[model samples]
Target chain A: MDAIFKDFGKAYAEFDGYNLAKTLAPVAPEAQPDRLYNFHRSTNFSSVQKDFKSKILHNNALPFKLTSEESNGWVEVYCAYWKAVGEILNAEAATKTHNKVSWGKVYEAWKEMTVVLIRGYTNSGFQAWTVPCLYVAGKYMRVFAIKADEDAANNPSSAINFQDDFNPEAEKNEKLEDAARQLNRMFQICLSDRAPLEESRKWGIYNIINLLFKTYFKLGSVSLSKNILKALQAYRGDMPPLDNFPLSHQVTFKYYVGVICFLEENYVEAEKHLTEAWHLCHKDAVRNKELILTYLIPCHLLTTHTLPTLALLSPYPRLQDLFLPLSRCIKKGDLSGFDAALIAGEDEFVKRRIYLTLERGRDIALRNLLRKVFIAGGVEEAKEPNAPPVRRTRIPVAEFGAAISIGSKETMDNDEVECLLANMIYKLVLFGAFGLRRRIYRLHMKVCLAQPYPPPIRRDFSGGTTSRT
Target chain B: MSAAPQSGSAPTTNATSSDKNADPAKDTKPAAALEEDDEFEDFPVENWTQDDTEVPGDNTHLWEESWDDDDTSEDFSAQLKEELKKVEASKKR
Candidate 1:
């Protein structure tokens, strides 16, 4: 202590009182001026009435009002919508519940909330902190809640009354091609009017489309999915990045295309879009990025069959904790463990395609056989017959194995013959037509066989076969 | 003439006043000029024109000082107008 004090004394004397005061003078901490908040007021029935007026409603964007209560109004609205959704669901005791939940009340709550932000800020001019989010949240909450309700009701054991939830029949919901068209038109409207107010514009057409995508997915509307693809493709006319807009919106053209790929079960294309979307998603937006990547990992695994281990995803050191478990489950072929990891991902709070167990579990289970084809020294190495059996390709096995992260070097040696042959034959059956990819895959087949076989992997489930053995 | 000397004046006062109040003849120690210059010397007019990063943080006043050479405000505004025109034109395309 004396040595340190002497060193400091030699360099800088202890600041005298006046000198220290000058050095540590108080910073002018910015004090925000008082803001006007609307509280203790009854719901504005007149404004809700005025919503239908010609003066307010323009081109299907019925302007609505949302009051900014001083304390936790946004969260309160969310809770309110949650209640509304639950009430509608509880009423389903007597009704036929076949399709996904409609969650009309929650959707209505979201719609009303958007009206609040649009009305309060864009029209009446209040601060646009998170009212728009309520709109998006309510919309998707409605979709997922409805879908969950519908699915729950349909299951024999967990059967809640479906008839009361909503009146739509499963076949009718599918048959109503026009409903999907209406969803497109709704998105078109969301995208149609350029928001005059920059803040309200956060709930841009892109945001609405994303909400619709999730909602429609929840409803199991394949028809809606196809329409979303068309709308997205058409909407891809160039867009300049808006001021203060997040990076996710920057690559949205690619995003919608990826959503389409996921629906079509093109795991490769899904991963391509979803990965870009996840990366392009704002770094601080903790939940949504996690949600998107949750789907992306499985897509990477499904298409490539390689799980990104802790080492690969370490740059995002925060998510590395979740990565290890998810990767472990996939590599070990522990379905339940994989399912646990899918839920265990740090971003369970966000509603997205990849993170949600409902979407990813079944998809991964079905796609594992497909992804197992391209391990570095594993499946790709085992069955090499035609070529001179080089030890391994000069193109570093690490280069090809880059995306397909397998921690166990032994996985390559474990089940080489079965996984590789399965990969080859599956490719032969599924994509052997006279296309460029097919031709390339044909070359890949020769390359696949020329590599040495791996010993069979210890598997509870059979590999390389899509069907039950 | 230099920004360093002008801001340097404030810290010099601090040192001189503290030392003078402590004792006048001992205050004749040239620590005021030396100590004051140590902190203020880093912020030089030479640095003002070098690069945006040299200023560090959001020192808008320093940035404004860097462009004080010929009152380029008008020319800068005109250039921005041109950029806006290009933005609008590209959107039209």
Candidate 2:
């Protein structure tokens, strides 16, 4: 058995994983008096090899065999080896790398051993739960990303941060994030099916998406902006639909998406998504809502074709100076400045969005229940009779603002809150909240009329709404 | 010809073609079953379908016969003994 195995490896080392596969056709030692019955001589080697190769090309990660049957186990093992092959492929893809094979071919041979394991210890392999090699192979992908980033950081032409219209290279980065996000989809499917072993393997794959987003944003790259929204949809599907996520997650998600929309120049949609996120954002969470809202002002003003009055700029004092240059850019439609702003601050804005999405999803249910108690007029048990006159005051202005921002923390009952929300949604229905947009419109109109020159009608839903939806 | 097997996601032309190959109970090309082709797809070479019987490198380096009497082969034992003595000598010296 040892000699035959060694002979097989020696014979197959030169051919890439596929050519070596052709050798399977001749492994019928069974017809001879001397044969090792350690493998299945069933399927044609070419078909098996081709199937294994295809899955690896699509995803660097492959599922380990965990089924009760031999046929399924073979399929899983084949997928694992193909993924290892993907690693070598990925490394070959790096520029300035040398072509060749060496001691590293041992990994490829280990994949071949899966054939023996399935034929020899099919049930025991499943029982022993041997890990598939895809785990090792997938690490090469992260290594690829880090290497590419390091290269780009040192290159002069790579100065463009984030996916601006100027940076054609950003498209490839977007594809990488898309690939990572796909892992989350597979993980949820495994979790839902109650396959713990399979699910654990997929965990790293999905987490890479999160890590990738963090990495790209940290470098001021806007590559994850679009893909993260898609990932949010994936996360949204994992949790129940339409419930408030954790307040914190909602805040961050809203802020980042808002920033992306601002960068993308879809001001109306950006503002809507960001506003919805803000309205639902938590109080205890960091003031990303404020930051996102600061950017949102530019989004709104640009879209509405109105100038920010000195009075209106009072709320966001930190932004007054930065706002002027952007205002000039917006006035002239200087896209470069907007791109620069996004590229310069892409990380902080994007991080805020991710943090908000998780926070929103996590606390949506809790916030709704908490809001119920507040709406039901439940108060902190009457402060022990005579605790400083009970403060007998109306809601603080800040608390009122907080209550409005945290959509679930209102004094209104569920029905009233629902009614207000519906009114906002059905603006055409002539509901009171629906009329609120008309006021936002009138204010914009007035501001435009007062200005010497105006660009166009700016919609409030400019940035946030467009980015998320 | 077809949609390139969804770039690794779906069974593409390769899989479809292989489906047309020999028996299911005993595969003729088992090495293809362990395909690393998808991994090294651009290796400037591909699987040896009947259409591609002529491989690039010298295929004459036969190793199949080496296994005929490999069980009693003294090469591995002698190499192991030499390796052990080297380590033992290094420790003593």
Candidate 3:
């Protein structure tokens, strides 16, 4: 057994070293000065793949083959898969010329090669390595496809000849979607107990799941994303510790889940996840940290009525630009200012799809308005001596309307005011409803009055909150 | 293209913690799955711009910066003013 393991290790190192040398080898200095050199290298790659298959294919004695033993054969498979794909990426980066080797043909071959490599790795149960490799490779494919599409769209050459109006990006999108679906299938395989879930492999699942979410987001397939989140949640028991993932994956996963929940208007859960992501993210990952906070600040406004402090927004200038005006309006109950800020930021918000989420901030403004009326209505005398004075309740809906009208340039009617109040009640920003009609709810002002700010997240759950699978 | 009323979310319902624990596998029936049309019912944005992924993660500044150039803000503000006017007009009616 010891000898077999040793032999596997030796074979893996030899295979990997040879591929690295082959991939890195500079084009022979002067062998082919013409463009035909690309063809020569392509032929060389085919011969190398053939030699690789003859040596490593169907070797029953390879370590970690059928039984649960360490096998060096996995590395050779990994290196070969990477070397094949790496050649294309490296060559693309080597020159400024686009489509020198015909992207259409290369992508078709890669589509085939990805399937074979994935199938072979899965059969051997070497998921830990294979999943991460595939995750990154999948990301590169998505990025490259997008870059190609952009190039095709912007390349002046295409503009010169309007007759060939074929859209290459349409094909690229289909290929990317196909690749995403394939990765999802492989992820399902990795979820089983038979695949090795060693520490490193455990972290790889986060990367795979995150990339899957990105793909779904890009596809704008919300139902598919929802299904994937549900699937991941159901398999929660099998996942590793949340701390095991790299900070980027942890933050990215929580951000997506939080944004999804916010879209569904599940404010409480969104607050929980976004808060955790904000605090746990690496402080140096400035942009990501800022992105998490952008969603988080709005979640806090909705759930707790707490505004972000100047101190909090100081470190992130971009976030401050996004949230400061909105927060100030929510604080002062400036309805017009809030609307103006939202409109000013409309394109940015719509692009991020946070317009709907932040639109809910209007509730904060309304809450502040109602609270002002409560304060101005004055406190009635306490029932007993040495008791705190209770604020007056049951202020007329007409009075709230007048307060709302002050924030607007146009006059507001009683029914418009009632409609606004009804919405407030429906959203649960206010409690106790005795009537709904021409009249708004008769309030049990105590519920609205009792220091309505939400408590801060407890320390125990802040940094260590595990995602629902 | 069917002119369904844009805002279709049935007023906010309390999100129960049970949603956290419900096993999704047991409820895999396709009919029960949330439909695309249903989810987008409350989506207020009429026109979605193309991919916002200029930079990998921090595209907020990209949108803001791009809109600053070439009157995007003015266009969106006009659209917003028009929508607000419709709401006001509806309430008056």
Please provide, for model 2 over A1-469, each residue's C-alpha lDDT reduced to its tens digit, 9 standing for 90 to 100: 2233333344333322233232232233334311212222222345755543343233223233223364345445554443433433333222113332221332334334433433423243332122222222222333334434443434434455554456555544443353344333433332333234333322232222333344445446676547655654665434333233233333444555666776666778887876665455443222343465565555554443344454444545555554545443333322334345445545644544432221122122222222222222223335667654322222112221223333223344434444433432232211111122333231110011111222333234333121111
Ranking by TM-score: 3, 1, 2
lDDT of 2 at A350: 53
Model 2: per-residue Cα lDDT over B42-79, one tens digit each: 11221122222223232222111111111212442233
User: What is the interface RMSD, in angstroms, for predicted model 1?
Assistant: 29.8
Q: What is the TM-score of each candidate against the true structure?
A: 0.37, 0.27, 0.60
As for lDDT, the candidate ahead, 2 or 3, is: 3
Best prediction by TM-score: 3
Which residue pairs does candidate 3 place in steric collision?
A: A63-A71
Listed in order, the DockQ scores are: 0.01, 0.01, 0.01
List RMSD in Å for every model shown. Answer: 26.8, 30.1, 19.3
Candidate 3, Cα interface RMSD = 20.7
- For residues A103-135, write the lDDT of model 3, one tens digit per residue: 333444455545554565556544344344455
Give the Å error, residue A440, model 3. 18
For every candidate, what is the interface RMSD in angstroms? 29.8, 36.7, 20.7
Q: How close is candidate 2 to the true structure, as a TM-score?
A: 0.27
lDDT of 3 at B89: 61
Per-residue lDDT of candidate 3, residues B2-66 (tens digit): 21111122232422232222223213311121112211111112122224112335423322211
